[model samples]
Target: MPVERSRRLESYNLADYDRLPQCTNRRRLAAGIATIGPAIAEPIGRRANDRLPFPPSTPVGNIVLKLHQESSGALNTITSYGDGYVAINLERHEGSIIVMPEGAVIEWPVSSFEALAPEHFEALVAAAPEVVIFGSGSRLRFPHPRLTAQLAKHRIGVETMDFGAACRTYNILMSEGRRVAAALLIEA
Candidate 1:
């Protein structure tokens, strides 16, 4: 039989070390103290004065960060698809449909590529998307240029792919915050 070795860690009380000076570099300490002026002033809602002197050794660069927050479930995204149906935001639709990045899904009247007409693309134009993704059922196919002339008139671009590829592309475009619409034809 093998003997087991105890692996318990020895703990030290942190209260004993609280009185010790945290930072050893005097110049760094002075720079940190200098920067704290703006931090303390901001909470009181006062604009910080730019006249404060910084340590000459510290290098400063003009860098700005712009942040935009979006809720996870807010956008209407194509989540999954198959031969007979496409799912948007986890809800499955069996017929042809048009989906935009951040709005309700629109039911496209055409069920197959043969049924597409100039007016069939009008829904996409009304949505004013920057790009349109055309998914032609189970295989890749291109629609006649005249059918998409309305989109071209508005300078909106159109991309055609198979049903599966279109669903994948729509999700990618939606995540990028692009004005994209997917016209999917489910033929099964």
Candidate 2:
């Protein structure tokens, strides 16, 4: 039995050795990295030198620093938002409002999620956003599917969330150049 086990081990060792060359060839092919030459290194070095260590002289750095500055040619940015209000372009607005990324801030006729209806989404459809973010007052609440049926027919997507989360998501989507609208409901 001992001799048979030794023979089995030797066979396993021989099998492993047979695979070594094939494995090395596969690794080399997988890497697929061409030999680096001065052509690529020179352009990379020049581009790196041209870029500033910090952000360029633009309002972009303000956003990273959480400072109240809007980017050039950017749509209205939500600077501050809370339970019953959201600030657009540094202007405080009360009541429900629909914020379009490239358009105006129109007053939404909804006071709360409980008051939501199909008509409430009419303005959003008219605004023609690719996606609609519904901020359900102070908490995450979803309206009946029937209420958002109009949006679905228009091939628009809807995301439901709390007021704070909706505000943050809207800003991110808007900054990414997406056609988005935020239907924020502020319960009195």
What TM-score would every model get versus the actual structure? 0.62, 0.63
**lDDT of each residue in 1-188, candidate 2, tens digit only:** 45544333223354564366434443333232232232345555555434423332333222231236557365878989875789998889999998987767888777667778789987688778899998887878888899899899999999999999999999999998998999888888
Off by over 4 Å in 1: 1-71
Total clashing residue pairs per candidate?
0, 0
Superposition error at 180 for model 2 (Å): 0.4
Q: Write one digit per residue (lDDT tens) for candidate 1, span 117-170.
A: 999987688789899999987878999999999999999999999888898998
Cand. 1 Cα-lDDT: 0.78
Global Cα RMSD, each model: 19.7, 17.8
What is the alpha-carbon lDDT for the whole of candidate 2? 0.75
Which residue runs of candidate 2 sit more than 4 Å off their true CA positions?
A: 1-74
Please tell me which predicted candidate would have the highest lDDT against the true structure: 1
Question: What TM-score number comes out for model 2?
Answer: 0.63
Cα lDDT computed for each candidate against the true fold:
0.78, 0.75
